[model samples]
Target: MTRKVDYLFLRKGSQNWHLKLQYPGDLGQKIGRKRIEKSLGTPDRAQAEILALPYIQEHKMHLLHGHKDFRIVWKHRFEPGRQHVGPAGERIIATDRELIYLDPQGVITKRAPNGDHFIPVPPLLEQKAAVRREQLRRRGVRNSDDSIIDTYLKHANVTGYNEREARAVWSLYKELTNGKPLREATREDGRKIVQYFEDNGLKSATIQKKVGWLNAAINLAIGETKLSFNPFSAIVPKRTDSERRLPLSEADMKLVRAGMEQLDRRDQLLLRFLATTGARLSEAFEIESELMERGCRYVIIGRKTPQSHRRVPLPAAVLPFLPRQIDGQQFQGTARSASKRLNRFLDDIGITDPRKVIHSLRHRAQDRLRAAGCPIDYRWALLGHEEKTVAEGYGLGFPVPALKRWIDKIGF
Candidate 1:
């Protein structure tokens, strides 16, 4: 005869709980309960215990009837109501059971029974549900593991970023992915990534640009991929005003001239040419006598723009300072070294603002031309700049004498 018994399934290796049952078969076989465990996408031992209850009750009845087959026992006990068996024959009895599975913290997930499937309420969702739940429970929330990170990298193709700039963005994204849930990422997290670069000695401008690109990637994840949110929108960098135009004052110009006087003849000529022609430091360094002799009155400023390589009329004031034969050889020093030397010279002459070095002379020339009411088009041309209007309209061939007249007015 089959005897029904109420049995509680404590997970395998679980202690402090026992399944009580009565059966007609051998007492040893019916009394000694086997451990029942279930895998339900959770790590909590309590969840395993709770999920095994119905299976345990069914198994105990089968054992009492001298039945040793688990598959048949499961089919009779838990399989009638459910379509799927839990991992190890422990069937989920109540899919909608309000049983709370607590992590180390008091965080709890209420497992509710769906039509044919058991749905687990994730911790994050539980938090939202708790606000409306009559009873509140606390539980530990586990961050997304490294698996999520692997997923991000796999889809992002981060390894394919070949440019240094693109690679830098990917590196920062990788750093942010450390055990963080894709949904938990915030704009503050993006700010910290930008700050990491700044604190590590990257320039502020570069940090700003890199952070912007990182935000773009985060947006991509949110909009194009499966990520739930973009966390970069909240970061606000500290703003500092920058001065691109560093025109030298009259006193600063005098100091610079005095400093040039102290340099050797060739170096002095280079300095004078830079000051008078307003040529970029690199363009001045690359000047050749033959190029200058071909009526190339102006040296192009190639570093900033393609149009920057246009000719400005040769400033006659600069003629006195030109080398008899232009040193066909380019200047040997790097831009940084040249800037440092120029700064040292300025410092010696009591110019406190180091910005008044070589480039400041270019600013000063532009200022002088503007102050004299020189046409904006002419000034732009002299500076090798594209005009705001049609490019061809701006006189490509500036009259040498007219340019000289403007230079004479400046009286450098």
Candidate 2:
């Protein structure tokens, strides 16, 4: 068990919540107090819970990052919507119902005295919200869980995580928080979260991922609400040794192709595409069919990294059958859903190595590209990987025809 920081506490004398903060190092008292105590002001546990979150977050920021201003954290806890600096200098947005944040004249808007926007509240939107609220009520999803989950979900698209997956992480936190707001999440609450994972016999890596997701949510919430303290950051998850995912060999590739001979067309196409292009399953789905059909010149593989996602040349054989464009994402279901079936096929093919899943096909593609005399420069381009060194950064990578030749050699 790790030694804890008790940042938020319920006073035994007053029964009201109080903030107790101390920076880790014995640094300047000017940055923050040596020991600070402030009344959180509500006898009600629920209200106290909401009030404590940002102060706790602020204290942690001060302790770890030398954040000097505690007043900002104080405001965030009590007021979600307040005047603050914007790109255009000063701007104010209400707690909710804020988007298209400027009028034609480009002036900021203010919320009600309670920090909530009341006007322009559409009845249809209200009705939908009421229905959802009732649904949550019936389902027993606590109030404290909803906004925290929403915060994470809203940021998921920007952060490149599935909203459903991020919600699942906070759902666990919400269960732990009950109906209390995420603001009230104390050091003990964090300990309980870690304990829940450990008690359930989860692996350290799994627990770390879960906790990491929560920390991200907290950070996003803090950034928007202007709170700095994050108890989740304080909880260091234990690291575990993990298996290395080595690529499949040429012989192994032959076995995989042979195994795929019996798979469904969708699965077959998906695997073959991954193997040939050396694209991630994600980018494999998003290949621009129009670019692919244009003389098989280049297929757009949407990668997170800009340079890696450049137009990759398509193998000739796939051009005839490939669609011109996928509407949005390439796959309908999640990668996990596809992987469950893909993994089964991988196992059937005698590639029982856990690390060698559909992803390893790309590695095999790299291997085949190398075996076919493709230069390292062309290989990295096809694989959607960044150049390893500054020396390799001389020019734009190999042309389409050169990349095509190497990828062509490995075609099914």
Candidate 3:
């Protein structure tokens, strides 16, 4: 027959008590006693009763045989190879029906009953998962410089530059490609490219124009491509204000005029027309006979713009160099070859300043106009620039006389 057992508790000290599972031992010894106490310093019998139930349940088999107590059996359940040791020698335990073992150093190492080592769950897994999800959301995004530049080229064409100018702009874009992604291109790369042009003897204006093209490429990348920012936006080109003007002095003018006398009559008139009219070399080269009205003292020709197509007055100094009848024909030779011949004339005259070339005549005209007190408005009109206010809106058309007056004041 199976023997029934019950737990007995006795107050030992202030709050501690000895709890024994009562059962018959082999002839005499009663079941072993285990300590039961509350951490609170109170002799509360209710606390012992609550703890005694589980203790008895766990050691019920051993308790009935009178071979062990609740604590001893419980401790044995936690030890890897010793499920029969008494509580004092069992350095392991079980709770929540799961085994928990402590190393000799008293550090609790596990909570599983299978004796498997435990690891604290990492707290950052959720955060890492969120980041991974975001990365996936942005994958397959396009960000190539070529794609950006192609979009810009399409828009630039609609905005009015010819194929040649557009091609020049693209050449600048190619030079800026360091084979890195747009996001990785930095301001330092822009600075280095700017410095390279400067070191290679390029003029500041040329460098600025080249840099402007590069900046346009970067802007296109930002506005039309996937790039969110332009690395070259903040980079400023170095300025060399000293090269702004290269006007001919009176002595230099005399030498240049004398050299003109050595050329053919038509060529002499061409040089005189350029000096007196302050026309660009290309504009002057493209002039037609029909554009010139006899006795009108002004020539009207098509230029880069309608505003640029204005009457350019003939100065008295230009009369001696004019032909009896103007002929409408293209220059027989290239502008470059003609420029070389003109430079040779300057060399012969001993004007050593390289900047004192044919373009100097235009600068001299501006200088002369300023010296004669031509108003800024009149000068701008003579130069065929769009009026300041009009440029802000449309553009103003200055009367031919107003432009002619400014040119007349710049007498040879």
Candidate 4:
């Protein structure tokens, strides 16, 4: 006698077992089929039952998730028959009887002719099936352990300090969200991030900047990811007044000037140049001596900002202090090291305020220009401040000679 197996049927002439399963009424319309069938491609019933488990699980998940294409190999097959209801309220008119059915708890059970049934899955196999179900359910869903920050950085081609800052902020975001995928990050997570910064004593402006970077990055990647909108977009902390660099007093200025001669020639020249012209420390370091040797009275300040990209006129007082000729970059070390050295010099000269660093000299230059009765346009142009009014943006700005006239009023 041939043994009967759940979810497996043998045709009249063939000894090979075939798999068949009936879809519940609701799922049949969605999958566009009332039943699913496929060849197990084996003569042995044991091998066929083993192969049938995947199909059975796939059908269960497909019905559970309402996915139409859970298993590609099993195609839909419908056969004509008169409708009849079985004892358990299952349709009995299908071409093949479904011996396997999902119980109330969703466990697969084998149904016998005498109304007896038992779950076919052992505990170990059931655990693995649960994992497989999760994998199938999450297909095409992003956030399943993928690094969204790395993907965004790769696509955006972010590099340098910007890349480093974004990565740093992203790391913090992960920590705040308990290392959740950035795509899975929610508005609540953004709130938590802001709260974290505030609790750590970060100023509102700094918190805003860090959050803004994260917001802008996610905004750029919204089109590629499944996220509807950036969670950090409206979560920015309120803006607050930023710290200002204190301008040097006349006595402070005089002290710096008198102390310049006590330093090395390079230090004296760097200090005098910044004090007179109000050029940024980085911009000053970028001034190639070769460009000045060609008799260019102005130095280009391109690396800072579009407004700072203007040519700053060399003040007449500092002209005697400039190197006549040198190869490559004018300053030896990086701009950061140069600022540290200049700040130390200020501290040594008794101008020791936290805000009275090397950058304060730039503020002093504007004050000096204002004292000399330089017009507002000339002051804005000389200090590389962005044009505020429509009229200010109209011209090529004050001529180099015109800028030199006002800048000359300030002495080292």
Candidate 5:
């Protein structure tokens, strides 16, 4: 079977996917419909999931407003173009461009300017839906755990949803419930889910994060109803597992420098770049060499933090490793490989704790700042960290010259 994403569902026999959504309010009474489902063509489960999401959304609009215009838009949206697999797994290519339409009497039409024909959707195609306003505004009081998840994800669709986090939540929820009604779900169910994660050898802190997201989702879905309780209310994910890798000792730093010498010129400079400037491995790998300059005191970090995109002063150790200017990226190869190479060197130098990875250099840089009497606020700002204090967010919290001195102290 194919992977399901929200409203997208895969057909067991046909191997095709569909979207299913619940219609809202008394609007269903007017249309003899309480739900909507649409076939998202393709035996390829991945593409169907992609196409179904937007279709479910449009279908939701039709369900809510029940307008002929919306129906018309939905009907012709999937123009029979290009190629798709036939019902029996045969290769079916569009002979010509054709559009599917739905007439008022629930008839489906396939219109081609070349040859005119209208075909109704087969009974098997009647399968999927996507709910609109996954926003808690409408789905809040809905009873299902799925409703809570839907609402939370819909909200995240705007700000941003961490893909890893979303996957973790679904993996746990999928194993825990068969769309159990959220209001009926209890604290015990939540605890059971956490235990499931632990049984699978997941870390306590990671499971805690997943629980946190579920807790937030349940809170969002608790509208004006008889139920005022959240199932995930009692999930405690302590921060004991947090990674706070300290700076490498001065002796260890020298060992790392020596290890860099063992690498080729490109990787040598790249590791040095990360070590001294605290740039991410990917950032060092993506530097458009044209951006670098000779004798420049400061350089802008990559786009990972746009708000903190101000120039940061470079330490002297990193300066010797620079080339006058090249075309792009100091290093070659994938970021993963680069990290593996760095780790191998760490292992060689007798430093191989799971927590003390390549990023510990960045931590050490911060320690360098503190040892040099740099303020905590300035230390983070220099590292292009999201300034923790509101004061940092307000304005140019620290002037360039002052910040320059702190970064200058981050030397080998």
Candidate 6:
């Protein structure tokens, strides 16, 4: 039996489930897609749901870390004077002077001057072959010549999302160490990297994150590559008391409300959603459309972190301007673009304080809750904060009506 999935829609005359994802606002123009649709190739509801998971995850990943083109790197090998088989099982009768070719669709063929058909290698084939050659070259490298950063990165067990962050750390480490091999890197090399960040005036948090990523990579290499001590181990950054940014103030909120008229409809809705619901910018933008279908009643916020995932009731004052779900997403554009536009609007509206930014609206919501005398437990649950004690984690935090009661207390 088939059940309905939010993004999986069945055409009127078709049984196969199809995924239709629409990018929000300017995101469509940037990603080169107003919407992307793909067939799930399943009539059974359960199988369709299962097949949709990867597509949904990929879409969400793109939302978090801008869009990237999708391509599958095909690996093909051809030897001269020997019969070779292609991915699709097409037999290529090789000649001694044969030249291998590949097409855009990843099909491999051979060309021979001895009256054999001339198969043109697609440009994509050359790109894939170059990558294959690099892999082969890396495999041939001895431990003495192998780069610590490169080796650890190649073998690092990171997800597609985190891979980008890991590589970014590798880029910095490679530059700092001048591409030094694992065997050659000293603890001083690690110190040099930290000192470079400090010299460049990077924030303590940013420095810690980059160093931590490199440290973890080296640690992984130690276990798998049988290296000695991690050069980055035991090199922790000292904690610093950073100036806390003021949450959205009463005057800041007024200025934003006044400036709301200048923003686009979508931006306006996003601001109101954040101000009313107190959702993180990412949480509000990437929230699932299926989670927004309570008929303007409430919206559920879910993120990678369990503590940040919770159900937030929609305030009635802001209901008239609530955003409509497009495709499977509640809002359009992206969190990044939305933040930029909102901050710019804030600057224009005379809210020039760096301590008060777009996120201050979320702070205003907390203030409203606190001023209304909402309980601490309710505040924590509504804001998706982690449980403070064992008792708070015992059951479902609160009923929707109970959550709604506190939400109603938040006057827009």
TM-scores of all models? 0.44, 0.55, 0.50, 0.55, 0.50, 0.56
Q: Model 1, stretches more than 4 Å misplaced?
A: 1-193, 200-240, 243-246, 286-296, 325-330, 386-389, 392-397
Q: What local lDDT score does residue 348 receive in model 3, on the 0 to 100 scale? A: 79
Once fitted onto the true fold, the runs of candidate 5 whose alpha carbons sit more than 4 angstroms away are 1-151, 157-161, 200-203, 223-229, 237-244, 261-270, 279-311, 314-316, 319-341, 353-355, 384-387
Clashes of each: 9, 5, 0, 0, 8, 5
- Give the per-residue lDDT digits (tens) of candidate 6, residues 116-203: 2233344897768766665444444344433555666677545444555666556555556666775677888788877887888777
User: Per-residue lDDT of 4-94 in model 2, one digit per residue for the tens?
Assistant: 3366576777877687766554554557457668898877656766787877765655554442211122223123455444467544443
Cα misplacement distance, residue 291 of candidate 6 (Å): 3.8
Model 2 Cα displacement at 267 (Å)? 1.0
**Lowest summed lDDT window (length 10), candidate 1:** 68-77
lDDT of each: 0.56, 0.65, 0.59, 0.71, 0.63, 0.69
**Compared to the true structure, candidate 5 yields what TM-score?**
0.50
**Local lDDT at 118 for model 6:** 30
True-structure lDDT of candidate 4: 0.71
Of 3 and 6, the candidate ranking higher by TM-score: 6
Output the lDDT of residue 259, model 1. Answer: 68
Most TM-score-accurate candidate: 6
Predicted candidate 4 versus true structure: per-residue lDDT over 1-412, tens digit per residue: 8666677988778888888899878889877899978788899988888889977886776665654322222221323244444468554333332334344564645543322222334478766877666644443243443455667677777666557667667666665676666556688888888898888988788888778777866776777665666778888656664667898988998898788866787877788888898888878877774333234477766455556666677888877866665345666677777888889888888998877889998888888888889898777787776544555456567667777788898777
lDDT of 3 by residue, 1-412 (tens): 6233235444455455445644444423443544323233235556655656765664554443342211232233353544323355545554535666676686776555533322233358765775655544444233455566566667665333333344444443345553456677777766766667777887777666656655776677666556776766656555654465488789987887677667766556667776777776656666555333334455665355655665566666775655555576535464556677666777878777877887787788778888989887677666666533455235435555456656777666
> Which regions of candidate 2 deviate over 4 angstroms?
1-145, 155-161, 191-210, 234-240, 292-294, 303-308, 320-332, 371-373, 386-398, 409-412
Winning model by lDDT: 4
* Candidate no. 6 TM-score: 0.56
Clashing pairs in 6: 2-45, 24-332, 24-333, 25-333, 248-360
Q: Write the residue-wise lDDT of candidate 5 on 138-170 in tens digits.
A: 323333345456667776562333444654565
Off by over 4 Å in 3: 1-154, 157-184, 261-269, 285-311, 314-341, 385-387, 390-398
Task: Output the TM-score of candidate 3.
Answer: 0.50
Candidate 3 has which clashing residue pairs, if any? none
